[model samples]
Target: MLLLLLLPSALLLVPWAGAGRIIGGWEAQPHSRPYMAHLLIRNASHKFECGGFLIRPDAVLSAAHCVTGKKAVNTTVILGAHNLKKKEPSWQVFHVGHWVIHPNYSKDKKENDIMLLKLKPRAKLTKEVSYISLPRHNEQVKPNTTCKVAGWGWTSTTGDETSVLMEVDLKVLSEKVCENRFQKKYLHQSMICAGDEEGKKSTSRGDSGGPLVCNGKAHGVVSYGPKYCVFPKIFTRVSYFEPWIHEELRKFVLQDLPDSPSSD
Candidate 1:
């Protein structure tokens, strides 16, 4: 009976294209990644997860597909959390006040897949909560550059979901290589390709929208990957959209600040 039941679960390991999660990675040190944000999004029928990072007290960066058809009322952003199952005192929860998806984002083409979330109430800066820096305008990452991505979700296609966050290091690949693999129609210049050449490490289902941190800065956003999660994954290049990000943040990131207590 056990074998019978387990057979169905085993079939889930089969390859299929979908959102990705961290694979071949270990648990991240609690609260070490202070800017990490875990998003819980709901559609009409069910809830799903995505990853994001804080860019400002009131602004977060994620993939457009994570919220393409979702409503603000059904979305929740959780920051300062290392373990999603625990009631960590450092956790900060917020509702999305607004969403700013790239105007050219296309779900089918998977081009320009980026989005920003404006927190309803600005996140309070603390030891476990803060923001990360973005790359300079048009600053591009070279092929073979090493970067790290983190998120909380399935450890493998057939494994149980991880309660704590996880991360893995991936090496960027050349544009020519990516274009060859995904083709020009799918792999736009605005995207990045990264993963282990041997297919040992990758991002599998549930890790979409996470940050790809390189040199202490976020350079990419997790977008999609292969069905088996064995090949290189594609990320929305952060540097390519720096100008648009700045313009959006400038509009309302500082609005309605709470007054500080007056000192006599």
Candidate 2:
């Protein structure tokens, strides 16, 4: 039996995952997370509120909620960026051609929190820009396995977003532990749990829609986190959605993607 969440909870989706980087993390190298791509809006109030990763030459993986109601034409994806506040030669921006959010994604339940963006002009694979490797279908990460999560999220829970990209290491916890600690009903099996109880590391404000890499393969997507970034973070299990990703990407790039030397 599952208990209904009767509390007046807005379910604050923290924008960043790195605790001032996921609490006790550090700044990552410029090209460490090469696949990392920050999302921006077209308006003058353009903000790097969300994060993403390049899974293919013309496709980017992100959270469905990031573009749920927004116009796809106004969105842009920036890649090879080490710092958002500084101009770097490695950074390149591209317009979004199409938005492919998961069909079953729900705003209320936060289920299937994944989406894919098609770039207008395919990105050129370079030393500072490349695609991340996705894991095989249905692969499950064992408990206590340390994985890497990087983003331009806030440096602290209540702080502003980080100017430089931040990367942090988190240990994967079993689904049962996450359910028991939080609301059992809300924690879906398609989600992965990873965090530190010591309040040392966590995903903070504006770190959503980033990748969670384990054993050198992207296996999770930063979907949500606890209030104020104090508890373990919840990520959409990438392995569980492998089929959706492959299907969506195949629609764009049917031919084989050229192999390029990655510096990440």
Candidate 3:
């Protein structure tokens, strides 16, 4: 039963030939539902349809590549959200006061592909919009462990957008099996693999920067998908980056505002 829950989506390796084409002036279909969500920081404009988790009242964790190649000053992080197509009464938009990408991040290999964003103003905590706890360094989740992945990415290749926060059960995969499957071409120590190896209901496009959570804690950040978008996908391991995260958080707290309280 645990293994079955980790199944990947059948569309992993399938190609969307027209994925590059834009329809209705929208880069891609708007995620079906949008609420306090992360925005994809592109060169032109930002879109609030990706996954993210509030790590602090004023901080959010997401994929580094999401904001790469874009100006940090112009970036924005939309939170307290619920619907994407239309504005909700609780939706709030905050400017990205600053951003910190892992210094060792590699676009070619997509290593250490995590990033942290500091929002202009702190968010108000609530049940609908809240922060996810960070996993302790050295904490390990055994293989076949059931977890949950949430995102606002595309639902299907030809299907319409997905809800603001769609969650699916998943399981962790052993490093050995993961390496053998991807030939180590994408998997790295800083990343963990999850989903059904057989490809049944996996994460896909626009899901990048989302969270792979377990026991109410954030264990990984969505990074890459199967080249074909078929099998289990890889996520940046949050545990391995604990030191860097703390350092960045400390720097942000000191420089941004001393009065800012720590989430921990």
Cα distance off (Å), candidate 1, residue 104: 0.5
- Which has the greatest lDDT? 1
Against the true structure, what is each candidate's TM-score?
Answer: 0.87, 0.84, 0.79
Question: 1-264, model 2: which lDDT tens digit per residue?
Answer: 122123224445432333223446789977978899988755445444678899888888988877775543478789999988997988889877577889999876668989998875788899999999988888988889999888775666556556888888888977765676556434555888887756577766566788889998888888876454456677888888999888877766643356643211
Q: Which sections of candidate 3 miss by over 4 Å?
A: 1-36, 45-49, 70-73, 186-188, 258-264
Alpha carbon lDDT at 135, candidate 1? 93
lDDT of 2 at 45: 50
Q: 122-191, model 3: which lDDT tens digit per residue?
A: 7776555677788888577778988776565465655456444556667888886666555644455578
lDDT of 1 at 59: 88
Error of 3 at 61 (Å): 0.6
Question: Poorest 10 consecutive residues of model 3 by lDDT?
Answer: 14-23
In model 1, which regions exceed 4 Å deviation?
Answer: 1-18, 70-72, 186-188, 254-264
lDDT of model 2 at position 59? 84
| Selected candidate, larger TM-score, 1 vs 2 | 1
CA lDDT of 36 in candidate 3?
30
lDDT of each: 0.80, 0.74, 0.64
